[model samples]
Target chain A: METLAELEPGKSPDVPQVLPPEPVVEIKASRTWLALNLKEIWAYRELLYFLTWRDVKVRYKQTLLGVVWVVLQPLMTMVITTIFFGKIVRVPSDNLPYALFVFAGLLPWMFFSKAITQSGSSLVGSANLITKVYFPRLIIPSATVLSGLVDYAVSVVVLIGLMIYYGVGASVHLLMFPVLIVLMTILALGVGMWLSALNVKYRDVAAMIPFLVQVGMFATPVYYPSSLIPEKWQWLMKLNPLTGIVENSRAALFNRPFDWLSFNISVGIAVLLLVSSAYVFRRMEKSFADFV
Target chain B: MQSIITVENVSKQYRLGTRDASYGTLRDSIVRSIRAPFSKSQSKKGNGVETIWALKDVGFEVKPGEVVGIIGRNGAGKSTLLKILARIVEPTTGNIKLYGRVGSLLEVGTGFHPELSGRENIYLNGAILGMKRAEIERKFDEIVAFAEIEKFIDTPVKHYSSGMYMRLAFAVAAHLEPEILIVDEVLAVGDAGFQKKCLEKMRDVGEHGRTVLFVSHNMSAITRLCKRAILLGDGQVLADGTAHKVASSYLNSGLGTTAVREWQDLEKAPGNDIVRLYAIRVVDEDGQLTDVVDIRKPIGLEMEYAVLNPYHILVPNYHFYTEEGVCAFVAQELDEHWRTTPRPLGRYKSTVWVPGNFLSEGTMIVGAAISTMDPVTIHFHEQDAVAFQVVDSLDGNSSRGDYAGHMPGVVRPMLQWHTEYHVKEN
Candidate 1:
């Protein structure tokens, strides 16, 4: 057989004076243990942005209330919980107004739950992109999680309004609010990535996430303060990662003392889950196109 | 001088039974895990576990600026190899090295949201296809113009017709510039004009010294766009050479084209008691059986059948289809002596001679049928009874005459042209 070079007459015309350097890519058959390849992820950051923007834009396209629903969703839930627990059950609100106290906890809880539910099924939802193109598979779930931040950001306005109505003043503890949000985001990303990866294979993860989130609300300190738990079972509540973030968020909002032990537990578990879940996600990502 | 892409010993294995949706449930996984230890001996016996090798030890090298066509029938591992090269799917065992960025167009409008407008989908689809935001912005106008949807750019894709959606999707994909572009049957969609534009864009990419790997069932398009072709069968490269050579190999290998077919038993033939198809064959001018015919020579599709109870005005017709499955034309026995008269019960032969320079170069599959026109009753219509390869000549005598490039058409008839030069005496 004649080589292509021989079949053609000569070199291609308009060869540039300065040729761009071509990057060499090597693909092998070995199993990937835990290669994050963060550089590739960074290179595709714009795709992550577009995907996130698409999700955010399409989420409320034809809805009548639109962004109002973002604030209304958490606010209505906070009102019912405040009425049921604070008025009927006489749950202590740690000397703060019941509305402000529960609203603060609800903020982080809503963000985490929405992120998990959306990101858990994200891989299955974007199976078209996964099977068609080449990019970091992690971006699909990451985009969904990031899009939830839009709703979270919008709901924060209601938190500030409730604090003002309750005459609660901001304290220096509020400086740690952003740090607590970061920790919450890390935890959400961890669980979201794990569930999304497994959802590619099991598909039961999608069905089980809503129930898990429902159980998770009571497990965390979203409706009631962590102080409501008796000292005997306080260790069990401390085991929940969201317990520290939610409680600390409330502390930051209402000038309550920070729980150093629970905060450190949240930090430890957040980082550990982030690392381990990322490893699992990368391991399962290779076969995602086949199964998803 | 150096090759730009190298694939070594690539193979892919897919588990048989677990491909469907019912297999991947959580309970199934849990049960499998629980039964893993106890079923080890049974698994070792290999009774239930079944796998098929989609690709097996395939290897090739491509230099820069080469356009290669991968041609194969369904389930022939062509798409699997393209997916592996595009990095969308991982091979079971292999190594691949590439020297530049690779762009793969496996499907158009992969992540398009129906709620998003055409303009929004352009950017979104471009990013999903691995184009940067800046690059999409740079070519935004060109994409809209190519799609011919400037007026509807701001309209939601859900409201736009599917043609407009496909056009916008293809426009974005067409503007993507990568060192190596791998396309898999993307040209199979869109109308004739859109497909022509896409083919032109592909040729432009090839001319820019970018290596291209095109997988297509359209033989004419494959021969038109690619200079080299690879024929794949049963997870391996069956032939790799010049485009025409590999295409003929693929066509004559009983994969795409069948030159002759015969029904040995009349009782089991495809027909009722009226008539039955006996045999169908493609023959050259010399009346000899042939699978490949010269473009400048007439070829006949000869059908021999038994007229069992024929007092019917039988129409022996041949439906010719290109390799792309587009019907070229149909020919019936109109000038036969038995056209007005009823046929007596006997075996008869009917031949339809397709004139030289009438058919374009590629595989032509002929479907033979015996039908009556009054009520339009088809006795026996074989879908693909016989097929032949029409080879275009490079000799300046043919219609394409010295161009030596891809001429897009279903027929390449040597139409008459007359020109008169008017020169003023000065």
Candidate 2:
């Protein structure tokens, strides 16, 4: 019988040992641009899931209340708002119960605020990871925002309990809750990307976030409705993205009609800010490890 | 095999400044932005910012299945190159083309959360290294077995010992099947046995047609694992070729020379006013200057100093340290004979001889200090006065050749050895 080596005549020439060739793709220089490579991110979806889950686990781990802290945080904030703004300042609640109205506005505001605050500091807090590994830096802030949603979900339950206690009937328009939630997330993330990138180079941004958040609470229409403002000034209030969100959330859940003009403007600004901030973030992200 | 990574003329420049710029408040930024339109200073001072090029026009290529070593002293741009290749930082100039997924172990336990368990940290670290959850699960048992911390898998990592933490961290990094893996000096941790195991695992990884870029100070380990090595000096590649050739060039380049006298003024030196060290020299027994000192012969340390005033009791102390900065031996003149003598104001000299077989093959540093006694007052104390090399006394002729190669700890003394045999059988 012929030997296996002899059977294949093409392998018998010089019998030189074959070695693997090196990858020879050459990268070219071009004008700076922004592209998400969403397909690649999608392919690595399993890794993203694990990373997001790890963030949730690491966050609640070793805590005294575990996941219950999620519920308690927003619940306490709602109570505080009820006492200070609902009872003391007597802000109008658009004919809905003061507690329920503020809670509706507070729900989205709390989610947006927490997401921005946590994700703003996320890069600096994970310095060791940023300096050591090779991953999309956006994942850090994105995961932080995703993890805050857990608390948002828990807080929603408490809001439901409050509505039931007040004998308020549910509206069919409440189905739009998810869309409003997405809008709030996008707005928070847009600002978060800018702040996180800035925090790597200037840590003072991280230090100042709490003070900024406090000021933002008064700037937004959380305790009162945008309807209280004169019609001419209402357009100016729409410039603040959260104005449309808070008003629409109340209108949707309390059987009030949507504010079409403010809603359209809010959506437009949110999308624009998200795209521009993401572009700037990707541009600066390439230097995060070194500067951080 | 195909090349997995290509680097061409890559350079990274950075402007080092305070973490928080002083002019960073919102009002200040707004003012600066408004002034930018009217002021020529902004346009002119754009060139005034101080910049440093951490990497300078570097170029290299890594073929698939090749293990490359990057050797350099601290701040030689080795980490900069690794970070650029890992895409953690972008190069200011030039470009690097990566063909596939790249994983970098720049530090051990980087992404491990203290509150998370060892198992959770493993998954988190693996995902940060770009491994899918299913892939980590596939290698889960092997990683646990390799780390040898089975009982503590569910325990929080903060509760784990430092050694156990490093083991698990290295195991996660070792199991990552990226096309290219970049590792810094994380192997310096852990015990010798674990280091050996890690090296073996790295060899296995290289054998599986993956590219590796290793940066380390251990020349022997680099020679054993890497086929090609690059030597960096002053942010530039000095040599790149076969591992043995590059390592030999680096070692023989007189990079360890300590003869240059770069001391600051007497006030800046760590000494009091009574006595001050002017210079230190390392010489052979016959008084010939040399960098390498043999352990089989006597070595001399010459110290020159100035005494300001007359002192009743004078004491000179000499300390020897290993290359790794561990103090090996300290000798002081505590005898009564030296305490009674008085010294005049002038230059004073002290010499100490290290006897034969007193040290193994390694580098050592010498520190000198002078003080007066009666009430014991320190005058001059200079750390890292000088550094010299020591060669092993016993060669291959000795039965304990393993001990002759490399000995741990600070000092290697020639202890007494005896061997006896008795015939009991008829």
Candidate 3:
């Protein structure tokens, strides 16, 4: 190998007396919005994978229960929902077993909620990395969403077990599970990207996510069937993208006719939200390292 | 060779304030949106925001294969510039055109998960640094061998010692073969041996016709590994040129000679009633101010002082501090020196000689204090009278030896050496 000395002679002799070049692309947001450069993010896709894997590993490291926490979280939530909502409140489960209904709903809800919560705080949590190094800012939030999938997968197994115990036979519509999962993930990532970017500048978002998720759970059809709502109020229920997701998940599991209208609406809204939120996130990404 | 990276007129501006609540609250945002057109002028005036530009019109170009160092004091926008190049943060203005893949080791273990085994973290870090899966797989053995953590590669990184973790993290980062590599001061934390090794590796990477942008506080390393350097001060490029000259300028500015006097003023000088110091100087035996001090010859510290009282006992003490701020030695004048001596009313002089072979070649500071005793009662006292530098010739050569290049710690003591002849039984 050549020594650094032999490679270049004049460049390191003194501080080069040169001026900086003029900026080519000027970033102008509300001046308050983060100016994320999406082009840069697309350039560093490999980094996103490593960060996602890191989060997955770090989450289970040193824990006695390890990956069991992934399954246990949603499982425990399922038990509570079965006792409180199923027995106490007596919420109608649309002729399906209440435990299985809530479990199915909880699967997507948990994935979205966990992804949102983790991604929202990811920027601040990785302050050291943000400050010291340069990589696509989007990777931080994207990795959080991807890592949450590990837990989502674990929780899905519990749902399958519940279906077996309830003696519910699998239906052909069950093939739609992959599509629903993708829709749920995209929606979660959409909202997560917005929240994470906001959280970097406004810490209140970090503090408010749990309360927002709690309110969101009731707003959607997590514990009750959307059908139970009077038809007049049904339109309002359909407004929540998750309502369509949960109602469709039950339809697929029970061989019921797909709610093509609500399903299409949810897909449309999810795509819209994902696109807008991603744009907003990229817009606000420029100030992340500074504000975080 | 064509330029691999071209940075043109880049500047980043930041607005100082908390995020507005209207954007977060859907109701408030809706209300504001409805009223936006009507109250645009009012809201614009009420915005109450201020903007500060962290970087201003900075530009540079790197040839296909070049190693450049970025040097600056804290908050000089060096990190910001690197972030823009690494694509971690966007510049408010300007553009960076690059020719090939870029890998950055912005911080050591940047993507390491503590729960992940050392082996897993290697792949993760490699991927984060832009290595393909197959590329990392091919370099896995080399990385493990270089890290020297084969025994613990399967252990979780949270359990690995910091040294081991750093080694593994650096190993993965070093194997990256991108067209350009950006590294920050993560190497500052490693042991001296590891630091030297990393520097050598960085030099080798640069030598292999890859470009590198290095940021560090270690002037020696910058001079050794980078051909060119950019000096940033207060978010602007202050200088950019050859590494040695840029480093010298940075050191001169950072380690200003005048600052030494300010430091002396801050520290208490050693003195009491009988004698107090006004100034202290380091001089050779001939009393000339010299930069080089012989390790084997006596050097004098002449202290000029004033006497306050004639009836008290006074003792003088001298403390020596090394470049890394470690106190290496101290000398004191006993009460006997002042017991029978007449108390001079005004100004007086006292000189102390530090015998040769007593100090190592490095920057050092001297502090002196004077105090009086009346039946074990204490009087005036001051510390850090003056600071000085010592340049000792090691290995009987005027030029410092290569062995002294990367030793750790604040002191290098020259101790006794012995040789004996012995016959080995066959």
Candidate 4:
């Protein structure tokens, strides 16, 4: 009865003499557009960890302040923006203290911008690894994005201090903070993968990223609130995925009603960018070593 | 048994100067695409992209536990094939299949960070070379011990001397235990001790029933280490057989020999103001130009040069090297007439003879030079001017009498031997 149970269709009986076959790796010229090779990425997760750690360690090697710089960059930028716009130009902050209000928005903004900037040029910078070693090329930009999370984690502490100083209480909406973080990371990785792959062929992308990030800041309402924009133009503002992220982050912190419409839009755009950019990145990855 | 590796008609084509495309910019590409339909000539040019097929229909198979040497001159696509097998680059056509993990050492310290400590770099480089983190951790102490940098393990590699850096990098690479190992010419660097350690490590890997594909320019190393070899010529496999056979043929290939070299244009010949080299050739006892010499017969190297300066006492010399790159010996003209006396300005031919059974059986590369030893100023020196094959036939007459197997030496001199018979009666 046991032998009969084991004799299933398409199942061969075990052979005692022969060893089990090892995994066969096939190399071919053509690539299926849909083979994102997420399983291989999972297999190399430790390499991703090591590379991300290397990026974090090397970034602050020669710097005087080291990790303090991570906290200082966002803090100082928030102070300067608050003084220039909140004090001089009298920009609105949704009836909250301008510094605390902008700090919340600046948290996700800094991570997104810094991540994209680093990852856009990540492939070109790792030209040696790409040419000499065999690993998923997606891991390069992905490591850049992952490393930025450490910086984001440190910068989040400053937001905590600001909320307490402004007497802003935590609420149920704060649970959405984790969700917003995921959405922001997905968007950054997507855009970054697209840019990094393109940067291999077109170096002009590296030079253009910082400028584009600067322009994107003004467009995303990091210094001001979405309500500050006129009613008719607000819809266009929501088109920028960041607008929903920044606005909803404040909504969650300030205990306002969650903007499900804008949140869903952000989710949609993030997934779309991730899928499409992954497609583009995988399609162009084989030629990266040659072009780089 | 299934082959561990199967490469089928793999080819790679690289566009020359691809980065310098005129339409690299998006605006130019857009404009070109818009106008491509209107102008047949512009479309036909196809952006004028020139390409070279780096590998053309290369095919081979490797059984499990086989150690194969890949030998070729530069630009023969040896590195290209290795790169494709390593998955670093995709072939333009065809495919390959590997049945197990492959670790390729295209370079030492490929991902080594200068700012990282030696200890950190070991793990990082090991991981980059396709070793698991646990595997590196397990072999950590052994690696440090092998590199002989235990005292400075915590110090950043940027501060280590160049030799120490190379040793550490090689040590980490040596510990990679993969099912298939593909190594390039990394043995070319490092000190003799380090290179010997690498060779021993590779031998150990081969003995452990793993497959290895080694590429090296050192003929002796290839012949000693690999049992079989593949020779690539002009991006195609020219020969594939036993290591000694392929290596010897590679030495006799185009770059290794013609047995003759001549400078037709005097102004463009190799020389200085005092002398000019006209020709160099391998000659036999009959004084006829030849490239192959009997192992038990004398061989002569003839050099022709014009002495432009009459008052310079010139010493003409010849250098012989085995195909393994060992300098066999140097012979300087010792004729009393020209030893210390200067000759009048005229064309002169000097020949040096190497006696029978002198050079071992293999290719001998000859270099010719003339120098004045007052301050040792060389008039002209032509390295690899000519090369010839020393053929040892199994005729039972030479030093290797009746021995059909290989003989290992730089020289095989036939020494006089006498035997005295002894009888014991009980």
Candidate 1 residue pairs in clash (backbone atoms < 3 Å): none
Q: Is candidate 1 or candidate 3 better by TM-score?
A: 1
TM-score of chain A of each: 0.93, 0.86, 0.86, 0.91
Docking class of 4: acceptable
**TM-scores of chain B alone in all candidate structures, in the order given:** 0.71, 0.68, 0.64, 0.76
In model 4, what is the error at residue B76, expressed in angstroms?
Answer: 1.2
| Residue B336 shift from truth in candidate 3, angstroms | 8.0
CA deviation > 4 Å runs, candidate 1: A1-10, A14-23, B20-23, B45-48, B257-358, B363-409, B412-426
Q: After superposition, how far is residue B29 of candidate 1 from its true place, in Å?
A: 3.3
DockQ of each: 0.32, 0.28, 0.24, 0.24
Q: Please report, as a residue range, the 10-residue window in candidate 2 chain B with the lowest summed lDDT.
A: B17-26
Worst 10 residues of 4 chain A by lDDT: A1-10
Where does candidate 2 clash, by residue pair? A19-B1, A20-B1, A21-B1, A21-B2, A22-B1, A22-B2, A22-B3, A23-B2, A23-B3, A23-B4
Count of clashes, each model = 0, 10, 39, 0
**Candidate 2 lDDT score relative to the true structure:** 0.75
Error of 1 at B353 (Å): 10
Residues B154-194, model 1: lDDT tens digits: 99999988888889999999999988889989887777678
- Tell me how candidate 1 scores on lDDT: 0.86
- Residues A1-292, model 1: lDDT tens digits: 2223233511577322233345367776657796798999999999999999998899888899888889999989888988998899978988887877888888899999999999999999888888889899999888988899888988888788878888889999999998998898888899999999999998889999999999998899877778889999999999999999999898888888999889999999999988998899989888988987
Per-candidate interface C-alpha RMSD?
Answer: 4.2, 9.1, 7.6, 11.6
